[model samples]
Target: MESSLLTCKKKISKKCHVPRIGTSLSHFEPKKRLIVGTKPNIPDLNLELPSDSEEEEKDASDDVPKLLNELEVEIFARVSCFEYWKLQFLNKQFSQLLKSGEIFKVKRERELVKPYVLMLTSGNSRWTMVDKSFKNFRRLPEVPSDICFLYCDKETISAGTQLIVVGKEVESIVVWRYELELHKWTKGPSMITPRVMYGSASHGTDAFFAGGIKFVEKGIPKVCTEAEKYNANTKTWTMICEMHKRRKFCSGCFLRGKIYVIGGRYENGKNLTCGESYDEVKNSWTLIPNMLKDITFKSSQSPPLIAVVNDNLYLLETSSNELRVYDVNENAWKRQGVVPVKANEASGWGVAFKSIGDRLLVIGASPLPRSFIKRMAVYTCRPSPYVEEQVWEETENCYDGVELSNFIHNCCVMFA
Candidate 1:
């Protein structure tokens, strides 16, 4: 006789870009608009998250245990790591699972949701899916797929409350945002210039988009020097000061309200050794000294993931997996830590932490057509040993008028 008892698996495995409609205002390429074509089957409304069925919540004894501890969370999260297994069945069973609230769910707003890190990466443009967070590790695949190897022309996180994703499909920059708690995505205003491979950073509610090359022809594009900004409240974009130089495949992060755009390859396709700073208050860009070591704005597909902690910027070269810190106040760069594993950026740029205090989590994905991982690898900012621990404990010997021994014997069993 064959056994028929159902057993649920723990740590299920995982699986696997842009907006059309951006441009580098400079060069004013008429053909810079990217293709914003839609697929035949893409639903008008795509839904993500598990349903809070009345039945599931009502039963406690029959409830499935939630893996919330850090280690357990990471393990189950690593299962589909880069959306490997996710893409496998996302079409059918996954669809039903999501619709029925079986796969993933949203946190209650009333409950204090512990702040966690969020890292975003869009996969092959053909079926691009946004790989998010190592904590909850969700596969909310709704991004439009355009071509084969589509990349994020640009991306920005709004206080981690929303994801302001703007990118170029072929020429135009398409804009979309993911509302964190709601677990839903909504369309937003597009950029005037469609840019590919640009840098973005936000201060308060206003987001800034800068740099990125615009395609003028099939195989030719020019690095742009234009800068633009978008405000969530106004839902509008305003053009601002352009950079002193043109560069693409660069990275940027906000430090103490200043946007530091750094180290992207020049139009010449050479790694950029120099960087710059942009101040919105002054509406100007200030040229900074060249980095101590050379950093090419090559593709994010490789290394040099830049992130910020306490307004301090740092870079992680995937090629070396060596962590380097850039002290904004000191105006200097120095090595901080090293990653334990070697990360490949072949598919695209590895993810940099936008939320970790100062540690940036770097993740990458290569193809494994035959394996579960069709694309994407997941790794977090190997935590810093130097971070301070301020875990506070509340020692209550007894409630208002209760005795310790009385309560202990009443609620707990003491071993003999």
Candidate 2:
């Protein structure tokens, strides 16, 4: 029997794309204003003649200042990413200004861009996204049917507004790219080799995939050593240098322009303590020291989820719900605080972590007395040697039919 038992497996597995409404800022497209013609192309609407006073009021509303001053622009740049998308929809001038990169520049200069954690989980071919606040959510379009049942050992990365997801169905692997600006999901170049439980990381518009099981031969699945990268602009995959060792269920992050693959598991069922860093420019993989040799982890514990914040890598443990910061200067992992919510006893299989702005977003399922519930929370980790107590503030919860099982295969961070 498969580990994941789906309630809608028979009905959904054979179906294809089903359109759904969702939120994505998408690229700047000129809004098509309503045209009032006697014979309209879209004839379904009941067009009525407007009164003279109504027309005059509409003109006055349009005459309201369509542009913002320097100070006003600065103030508007502080709006949250979600609100910014909605504002653009209301005014074409706002859309044009936002697309010009002027607002992002001013925000960067003023240091006002706040990061909000975006959480995603899927079951029965439906993908749902929610922010840390839980007050806002967007139901993404239905996932592709080919890999709809392929729900375990998945990986995700964010390149700008695009969310890249890699997962496998049987021996074949599929790559799905979700465009935040366009609110669309498009297929990308699949890996040359099929694999599961691989490590992935993204920098800019490119992504790297490494170290997973290719396929089962002679009743045993072989761990992979070859690595590949995906170029978002070209929508193609390129082979990269092989790693020094084989790894699966590993944690990865792109820091300082280099790809780092941390601890994973081998075929023998023993966890790997060593790690490796891949230098894309150098076209070589450098073996990193055994950072986990001194640390202790349970037998069932998978590798921690890694996220880059201010050029430093942080790890979020699923077993203990603890956060650790890696100091490259000191070559040690500093103990941080624990997440406010506890994870399900399944060794944190449903938990995920991502670094948004200066805070860390942890999303997962917390085991209750008779059931499990979903939670989205944020925590602040300071850089100073001495820091204050950190708490995970719960923003969202699930009380409906949303499954609390290992539905969330992976989570990632993307800058809007």
Best by TM-score: 2
What C-alpha lDDT values do all the predictions have? 0.49, 0.64
- Clashing residue pair totals per candidate (backbone < 3 A): 48, 2
TM-score of each: 0.54, 0.67
**lDDT, candidate 2, residue 273?**
81
Tens-place lDDT digits, model 1, residues 107-146: 2222222333333333222212222332223334565545
How far is 288's C-alpha from truth in model 1 (Å)?
0.4
Worst 10 residues of 2 by lDDT: 23-32
- On residues 237-356, what C-alpha lDDT tens digit does candidate 2 reach at each position? 889999998988887888887999988887787788888899988999998777666456678876656778778787766666667777776667777777654553557566666776
Which residue runs of candidate 1 sit more than 4 Å off their true CA positions? Answer: 1-137, 144-160, 180-183, 216-220, 292-303, 344-354, 364-416
